[model samples]
Target: MQNFDYMTPTRLIFGKESIVKLPEVMRSLGKRVLLTYGGGSIKKIGLYDRVNELLKDFEIFELPGIQPNPKYDPSVLDGVRMCKENQIDVILAVGGGSVLDCSKAIAAGAKYDGDPWDLITYKVKAQAALPIVDVLTLAATGSEYDCGGVISRTETNDKVGYMDPLLFPVCSILDPVYTFTVSKKQTAAGCADAMNHTIEQYFVADSTLLNDGFCESMLKSLMVNATKCIENPEDYTARAEMMLCCTYGCNGILSLGNSYSGWPCHGIEHALSAYYDITHGEGLAIITPRWMRHILNEKTIDRFVKYGINVFGIDATLPKQEIAEKAIDATYAFFESINIPMHLREVGIDESRIDEMAHHIAVNEGLENAYAPLTEEDIKKILIESL
Candidate 1:
């Protein structure tokens, strides 16, 4: 175990009808509200009307169309301008991770005197931020529970994960009913995203048994519930479990005393999504197994063995190497079963920018310091294998 200091201050109002609490939560935070969302899906599902009805007393302003892989230029900039102009007291992010992520950046940027990109790129640290409250409609990225958000600069083809404790939402309303209408594609991708988050933390150099158990159980739960979700999107029990699992994914709670894995999969996948505008979770699913295969060696075999045996129930009596390989195969198969494109080419990425992406990832994401220390060449090879 490693020395650590941890706290998750995001108050989770979970279960059915949790959105009803949004009014009281927002009232406690402030009066002037910046309501953020993406693509008007909330309106289609009637959540938009319910939220408006509940918060009819508050001074509300709208910042709609916050896209996935949230952008910095218009969304973040416009949000900061709105906050500054309106003297916005709190932000109500009412969509998936993208909206909440954009809201988080806006929350931090509203208080800063400099460009929001500077804060996102870590050119400067944040001192204070506007309070954030979220109603989560997607069970991915875990942004509602974590202080980090991945934002993209489309012109520059740069996606950066920004982290600051002040960026954590003050409260999150997690009603699985909100996710009942999630498309199968998104639900599977969300499960892949959550699984990748856990595996990133699990495949570290040093970890406590407790943390390992947590990771393994979470992985199994996500896999099982994800399949259930794909089969029947209206299965509230599975949806609820998967939602909670993903909420716990990136919140720093599961890996409390574990050594850092440097989250190399995310580090690499960021480039794919940034460059190709690919779906974040689909890109992660495509990269994860290949990265696992590339990093599997004598030093990492034990971790793979445990993951195989515990999570996938691969026969523990099998040869160690066989077990590890089977585990990796099982991972790839799981993603394939969920209908995630298992190749970069399938997602419209090809060799043309493989070198550029590898260099970008090596330079920007610092994968050289990852648990297995992938070099630029290693990244290229993984990308090729993924293709």
Candidate 2:
């Protein structure tokens, strides 16, 4: 195994009644809270009122309307402003990954005087940040447990993933019952997103039996439970398993000692989501398999073979190259089976911006020396094939 250092400081409170622990976690965090949510869905599901009732003792300020591919504007900017003006102490993210992502940005921004984008883009690093506590209402993106968040700047079509240990929530409360109401579209998208997270790590140029088993188990659990979730949204077992899968995704547990993947699919999908405001997870699902087909070669066949045998139970005796190709095809078919749109045009993206997307990715994501090398031309080919 490669030499490495690892740390996961976030406290996880998970179970059926974990929401009851919110007030105590908030007590350790701060007194005045900056409460963040998206589009009022949490309110529709009565979570807003529930949180209000539970936190009746604490002072709260609201930052609503955080969107998917959560933007640096309104959510982060307004949140920072609220923090500065009202002297908000800690941030409480109360919706899905987008809300938590925006809250994370706001937490970092609230403690800095510079533009948050500067921090998000790594133009400046955060010296300190407001404490964050989250109540997860969705099972994707894993922002609850990780120190990274993807934020968009519409003016520049830039969607950047920002990471700083300072951004991790001091604690997260996960009650899977909260996700029982998520629409199937989002349910499938969430599963696909979480699955892609593990696959990205699993496909890297490094190997360790530790992460390999974790990746395979996480992948199979997500796929099987996600399908069960689609068939029955209120199945607590499926929702719990999926929520756990997403939590494991961005938290670095599945990638310890693995080589850097450059997260090429995420880099490419960021362009689509940032430009068109597509659902981040759905965009990833649509682009992933196509990228897989584009990148498969003799150099990368074994990882695919192992993934097929371990995760999907493909026959091990098949030709190795054929196993790899079938694995790629099975991946594409899984997204299709979940009703995720499998092509860019189907999602309103087209070839016109493949060159632009490629150039932007080259400039932003630094995919030149990724695990599988991808030049701008290579990125364009992948994008074109995805289309």
Candidate 3:
């Protein structure tokens, strides 16, 4: 096993009626609050009213319309401005990963004297950040539990994952009931996102059997519960399981002794979402299977065989290459079965910017050092294959 250090400081208030604790949690943090959200889904689901009722005693400021992929310029800049101007003591991010992600950047940026992009791009390390509390409405990205957020710079078509210890939320409120109204498309995409997170860690070199089994179990649970969620959006059992799976996805716990994967699928999909403004999870779903196929070879075939037999229940006695191929095919079929686009063109991407995206990913994402080491050519080939 590889040597590592792991700690999760974010306090989780889970299950139904967890929102009632919001007042106590926020009061412990501060009075002046910047409430952040995406679009008006919270309002549609009546979460906005509930949160407002809880925060009625505290001074509140609002920053809404934080979009998916969480753009850096307007959302981050506006949020930082709101925090600084209002002298906000804490941030209550009340939407999905994007809202919490933007809130994190805002928390860091509000304390800095320079541009927020400096902290986001790692030009300057954060000394301290405002406290963050989140009510998670989406079960993907695991931003509520992790210290990193992927922020986009739209002008440059750049999506960067920024991690700072200070960015961890002080606490997170997770009520799976909030996700009961999530659309079928988003639920499937969230499943794909969480699965990719585990697979990324599982495929790395120097992983322990314990960690591999943990990942395999997570994948199976996500697949089963995701289908259940799609069939009946309000199924509490499925929603709760899926929510917990996503919560554990990107945090360091699942891969404590595993070697770094370099997260190459995320690297490539970052470019896709940054360029096309597609859903982050859908972009990952489209790229994952193709990347899997491209990276498969004699040396890596054994890992695929294990994944096939363990995760997908493929026949163990099958020939080595066939097992590997079946695993890749199973992955593709799973995504397709969930109604993911399964191709770049199906999501409005074409060959026009394939070279550009490949070069961008190679130059910016550092995927050359990934477990399977994708070069610019390798990235282009995967993009073409995905198309």
Deviation from native of the Cα of residue 365 in model 3, angstroms: 0.9
Candidate number with greatest lDDT = 1
- Model 3 bad stretches (over 4 Å): none
Model 3, residue 95: C-alpha shift (Å):
0.7
Q: In model 3, what is the error at residue 90, expressed in angstroms?
A: 0.1
The per-candidate count of clashes, in order, stands at: 0, 0, 0
Model 2 lDDT, full chain set: 0.89
Candidates sorted by lDDT, descending order?
A: 1, 3, 2
* Candidate 2 lDDT for residue 263: 85
**Which residue segments of model 1 deviate by more than 4 Å?**
none
Report the Cα RMSD per candidate. Answer: 0.7, 1.0, 0.7
Q: After superposition, how far is residue 325 of candidate 3 from its true place, in Å?
A: 0.7
Report the lDDT tens digits of candidate 2 across residue range 77-129.
89999999999999999988888888889999999998888898889989999
* TM-score to true structure, per model: 0.99, 0.98, 0.99
| Candidate with the larger TM-score of 2 and 3 | 3
What range of 10 consecutive residues in model 3 has the weakest lDDT sum?
202-211
Candidate 1, residues 244-303, lDDT tens digits: the string is 999999998889989998899999999999998899999999999999999999999999
Error of 2 at 212 (Å): 0.6
Task: Tell me which of candidates 1 and 3 scores higher on lDDT.
Answer: 1
